[model samples]
Target: MSTVLAIAKRELKSYFATPIAAVFLVVFVVLCGVFTFQVGRLFDRGVADLAPFFNYLPWLFLILIPAVAMRLWAEERKSGTIELLMTLPVSPGEAVTGKWLAGTLFVALALVLTFPMWITVNILGDPDNGVILANYIAALALASVFLALGGCASAFTRNQVVALVLSVVGCFILLTAGMPLVLDAISGYVPTAIIDAVRSISALSHFTSIARGVLLVPDLVWVVSMVVFWLFATVAVISLKKAD
Candidate 1:
């Protein structure tokens, strides 16, 4: 546990040293403002809730999460630092978990910075704080899922650009897995059970349900399972590459 925290602290500090971190935060804040006010028409809704913000959050994360996770392993391997990293006393699991924690927490920090939206909603009118909290929970889970997938992608390639593209594509599939267009495309060939399964596993579907303040046990399980699966997969990939 100490080893994991040490690695996590190192990774977290590294992010602050890079301009990318600053740029990402700026972009996130700006996009949230634009989407909530202009694109989402938050004022037009005449509601105190941040439903519009949550509605746009997942889509924004499809791009933002991958960009943030692109270097989790790709850059290290590209610079041949993976060899040094692996040689450390840290075990593969510890290293993987530490990096995952660091990346996920970085995204969480950006989410925290959006508290002004919550404050604004409060000042404007009375809203269900419980529902707002639920949506925030959903956002964090969605971010974890995206980052885990992105971390897996980064472990597979040394080029950050390749990592970013692969991560985005993977997250996109998960995000739209349950959408009508995607489901309809495969519905003709697949059985009803498979389609139902697809929707059941979709991050978007679960996120929507939770975002609406319907925090079912299944929704929580879905998010936790996907995040763990991808994180474990990333560890396996890194281990395999080293053996090669």
Candidate 2:
């Protein structure tokens, strides 16, 4: 546990050691505002709810989360520090978990900074705070899922660009799998069981379920299980790479 915390502290500090962390925070915050106000037309809608903000959360994260996660291991390997780190007493699983925790903490901080948006809606009218809370929970869970997936992709490559692209593409496919256009095309020939399974696996569906304020136990379990699976996959990939 101590070893994991050490690595997590190191990883979190590394983000601030350069301008990468600042740029990441600024870009996401700005984009959130733009998507919520301009693209979502919050002013035009005059609704007390934050539906517009949460509606665009998944699409925004598809890019930003990968950008944050791309360098977790790719830079370490590219700069040859991975070898030094692996030489330490720490285990690969611990290392993966630490980096994932650091990324998750950053997302928590980023979302906390967006609280003004919540406050704005509260001040304007009586909104369903319970639903808003659920949306935030869903957003955080979705971010962690993407971070873990991105971490797994990063473990397979030394190039940050490739890592970023792989993470984005992988996550995009998972998202598109739940879209009506994709599912409808598959429905023509695929069996109902397979289609149901695909929809069940897509993170987007679970996100919507939680965003509706229902807090389905299955949706929470699905996100958490996927996150754990990806982290384990990252550990496995690291172990195999070490062998090679």
Candidate 3:
């Protein structure tokens, strides 16, 4: 546990050691503002809640999370530092978990910086704070899922660009699985059962469920399971690369 924390701390500090942290945070906050105010037209809706903001989160994360995660293991492998990392006392599982933790926390910090949106909605109207809180929780869960998937993709290749592209494509598939357009397109050719299964596994569906302020046990389970599965996959990929 201590070793894992040490790795996580080191990885987290590495983000701030460069300009990546500043650039990512600034872009994230600015995009949130644009999406919420310009694209979403929050004031036009006249709703007391942050539905507009939450609605755009998955799409925002689809791009940004991969950017953050593309370097998890890909950069180390690319720079021939994975050998040095493997020489340490840490196991692949610990390294994967630690790096994932760092990435998740970094994304969470970006989310926190968007608190002004919540404040704006409150001052404009008597929004349901409970629902807003639930949306924040759902957003964090969604970000974690993306981070894990991106990290898993990073473990598969030494090229960060390849990792980023793979992560984006993989995340996009899961995200759009529950969309009406995707479901309708497949409904005619695919079996109903398979379509239902695809929708059931959609990250967007679960995110919407929780964002609606009804955090069901099933939704929580799905989030935790996805994160765990991807983290485990990342560890396995790293192990294979280490053996090669």
Candidate 4:
């Protein structure tokens, strides 16, 4: 546990050591403002809640989160630093968990920086703070899923660009799986059970449910299970690579 925390702290500090942290924070905050105010037309809705902001989060994260995850292992492998990392006293699982923890915390910080949106909605009208809180929790969970997927993708290759593309494609599939359009397209061609399974596995469905303050046990379970599965895959991939 101490080793994991130490690695996590080291990784988190590495993020700030480069311009990556600043660039990501600036781009994310700016894009959130654009999507919420300009594209989403928050004023047009005349709503007190941050529905507009939350609605665009998955799409925003689809691109940005992968960018963050691409360097988790891909860069290390590309630079031949994975050899040095492997020589450490840490197990692959501990290393994977530590890196994932750092990435998740960094994304959480990005989410926290969006608190002004919550304040803005509050100033405008009597918004349900509870719903907003739930939405934030859902967003964090969704981000963790993306980060884990990205990390798993990163473990598959030595090239950061390949990792980024794989991560984005994987995230996109999961994001759209539960959408009405996707479901309708597959409904007749696919079996009902398969269709239902796809929808159930979609990150978007669970995110939307929690974003609406419907924080059920199933939704939480899905989030935890997805994160765990992807992280587990990441650890396995790293272990295989180490053996080879």
Candidate 5:
């Protein structure tokens, strides 16, 4: 456990040591602010709610999580540091857990930076703090799922671009599967049961429900299961690589 945390700390510090983290922070804040205030017309509507920001989280995570995850294993492999790490005394599980922890911490920090938006909504009017808090839980779960998926993709290739593209495509499909256009396009030929099943697997469906302030057990279970499954897959990939 201590070894894992050490790796996580090192990984986090490495992120801050580079300009990428700064660039990412600046862009994420600016884009999210624009979407929440300008595009959502939060000020124009005179509504004291974080509806726009929570609503935008699914899309934001689809892109942002991949960017954060792209370099995890890919960079190590690209720089030939993965082999050096493998030769260390650390176990594979420790390494994977450390990377996952670092990525999650980065997401948590980004989410925290958006606290001003919460304050803005509070000052503007009376917002449902309970529901907003629930939305944050759901958002964190969503980001975890994405991070795990990104970790799995990163393990599959040495190329960061490939990892990023694969994670983005996979996540985007899961995200949009429940949208009207996507469902309508597929529902014409698929049975109702199949379409419903597809929708049930969608990130948006679960997120939308939680954003409405309902945090059901199933939603929480789904997120945890999704992340665990991908992390296990990452371990499998690493095991295979070690065998080779």
Candidate 6:
């Protein structure tokens, strides 16, 4: 645990040192403001809820999460730091956990910056705070899943650009796995139960449900499980690469 925390601290500090972190935050804040005021037209709605904001989360995360995670392992490998990192006493699991924690913290920070939107809604109307809280919870879970997937994707390549592209494509498939288009494309031959299972495993499936203010335990469990599974897979891949 200490080893993991140490790695996490280092990774988080690295993010702050790079211009990418500042750019990411600025872009997020600006996009959120534009989406809420211009695209969503919060004033026109005259509502206290953040339904419009939450509705755009999956799409926002689909891009941002991959960008944030693109450098996790790819940059290390590109700079020959992965070998140095492997020489440390830290196990593969510790390294993966630490990086995951760091990325998750970055996502948390972005989410925190969105709190002003919450405040705006509060001042405008009496919204259900519980639902809003759930929306945030759902966002955290979705971020966790994407970051883990991105981390795993990063582990496979040394080029950050390649990592980013692969991560986004992979994450997009995960996000849209349950969408009507995807289902319709495969519904002809696949069994109903299989299609339903695919939908259940999709990131959008769980995120949209929670965003709608419906907090189901099964949905929460699926997201948590997927995050853990992907992180574990990342550790395994790193271990194998080290062995070779």
Error of 4 at 239 (Å): 0.8
Query: Model 2 misses residue 200 by how many Å?
Result: 0.2
What does the lDDT come to for candidate 1?
A: 0.92
Model 1 regions more than 4 Å off = none
lDDT for model 2: 0.92
Candidate whose TM-score is highest: 1
Model 3: which residue pairs collide? none
- Residue 11 in candidate 6, Cα distance off native in Å: 0.5
Model 3: per-residue Cα lDDT at residue 194: 97
lDDT tens digits, residues 1-244, model 5? 9999999999999989999789888888888899999888789887788888888878889998999998998888888888888889998888888998899999888888899999998987999899889888889888888998899899888889999999999899888888896899897798999998888888888888877788788888888888888888888888788523
Q: Give the residue spans of candidate 2 off by over 4 A.
A: none
lDDT of 2 by residue, 44-79 (tens): 898999999999999999999999899999988988
Per-candidate Cα lDDT values, in order, are 0.92, 0.92, 0.91, 0.93, 0.87, 0.89
lDDT of 3: 0.91
State each model's C-alpha RMSD to the native. 1.0, 1.3, 1.4, 1.4, 1.8, 1.4
* Pairs that collide, model 5: none
lDDT per residue as tens, model 3, 1-244: 8888998999999999989999999999999999999999998997877888889989999999999999999889888888988999989989999999999899889989999999998899899899989999999999999999999999888889999999999999889988897898899898989998889889998998999999899999999999999999998889877734
How does model 1 score by TM-score? 0.97
**Candidate 5 accuracy as TM-score:** 0.93
Tens-place lDDT digits, model 1, residues 151-231 = 999999999999999999999999999999789999989999999999888889899999889989999899889989998
Q: TM-score for every candidate vs. truth?
A: 0.97, 0.96, 0.95, 0.96, 0.93, 0.96
User: What is the per-residue lDDT of model 6 for residues 90-204, given as tens digits with 9 covering 90 to 100?
Assistant: 8888999999999999999999999899998888789999999989989988998999999999998888888899889988999999889789988989999999988888888
Worst 10 residues of 5 by lDDT: 235-244
Q: Spell out the clash pairs found in candidate 4.
A: none
Weakest lDDT window of 10 consecutive positions for candidate 1? 235-244
